[model samples]
Target: MEDWKKLYENPPETGVLFYNETVMDHFRRPRNVGEIPDADGVALVGDPRCGDHIKLYIKVKDDRITELRYKVFGCAAAIATTSILSELAIGRRIEEALEITDDEVIKAAGGIPSGKAHCSLLGVVGLHYAISDYLRKKGEATSGDKR
Candidate 1:
């Protein structure tokens, strides 16, 4: 596999070859890159196939996402996606945050490589899981719990 060897030897500097400037920026200095103690909602999700994992924390107040934080264990795209997702979710209603889509996250990060698009989807799914956990703790039916 000479081609594979060459590719590995010349890997992209930012870890993702086609990552735009925004993605590189976020990957280098991710926003909300931590855990929130006493968070209102917390979720941990992973893609076993790709070995990517994301942990999202949210603080909700009066049905609004007052704060957000995240930890990502993956490539540059994963970090950037979660970073942008945090920004989009904060200061918005929980329902609005839930509406944040993978495409929106990718676009906000200036677009990730097509091969890394799943990372953005992971960010969205992580948020959904966190929101569902919060609603459950509040004794409310989550979207999936509804008949």
Candidate 2:
């Protein structure tokens, strides 16, 4: 009990944020950071608390996402998460791509600090919105729209 208390009181040396090598690599040179002209679906989403915005573009071919790209204005966490999300989503089927989540993005980015968890949300939200747009344009029902 005393040891636990002491450990809790005198925690490890940590700063405000923690960014591992993978996170820094993605942040410094993010992947698929651009717009796809004539994109099949496009979506823009933002986080009010962080003032982070992302515009995701997708090109679908034969029910699969042939390409994925995005433009993000945010901190290092947001950028890194989004970059990883794009890489995971591209070349995936619509259903599989739609399943992409913030957790996966964070894991791929080497796990961001809990304080910056919302940064991962920005990317997954953007991807979902774009997929919704694509489904709507195809006259298919989205998970929410299938009422």
Candidate 3:
């Protein structure tokens, strides 16, 4: 296992493992960290297993996401992941945005800790939910929706 993982598994009683500079940058100055009042679609997703939740909002124009925003209530990883998701989704076509994966988000964020990888998955899931909501509102087929 990685040293960070070992440290996390057997944490010292008096210290905390700080997130890397990239993660800290995102967490401290998260982009698109709000709601879009005139959003074309909005989705709220939660990980019952981890008790983390995210609300994603999107504005679509000509089948492209013109704007993206998110509100996250979770750990630094969750917040950073969602922030990165918004950056990745904005200006992309709905299908293209849907193609975004957890791995991409993790890579864009300079890699999240293995134990917190689920947070990146949640970010992608949140974006998918938002796109699904947009399709549903437009009366389009949502058969491609993956959860």
TM-score of each: 0.83, 0.84, 0.82
lDDT of 1 by residue, 1-147 (tens): 998888777876664556678988888999998999998889999999899999999898999999889889998889988998988899999889888999899878876777888999999999999999898877754444454
Best by TM-score: 2
lDDT of each: 0.88, 0.88, 0.87
Off by over 4 Å in 3: 1-18, 140-147
lDDT of 1 at 65: 92
With a 3 Å backbone cut-off (N, CA, C), the pairs that clash in candidate 3 are: none
Candidate 1 lDDT (Cα, 0 to 1) = 0.88
Error of 1 at 84 (Å): 0.7
Best by lDDT: 2
Model 3, range 1-147, lDDT digits (tens) per residue? 699898778766543345678888999999998999988888999999999999999999999999998999999999998888888899999999999999999889887767888999988998998899898878754465454
- Model 2, global lDDT: 0.88
In model 1, the clashing pairs are: none
Q: Where does candidate 2 have its weakest 10-residue lDDT segment?
A: 138-147
Q: Summarize candidate 2's per-residue lDDT along 1-147 as a digit string, tens digits.
A: 998888667755663246889999999999999999999899999988879999999999999999998999989998999999989998999999888889888878877878999999988988999999998877854444555
Q: Cα-based RMSD of the predictions, in order? A: 5.5, 6.7, 6.7
The TM-score measured for candidate 2 stands at: 0.84
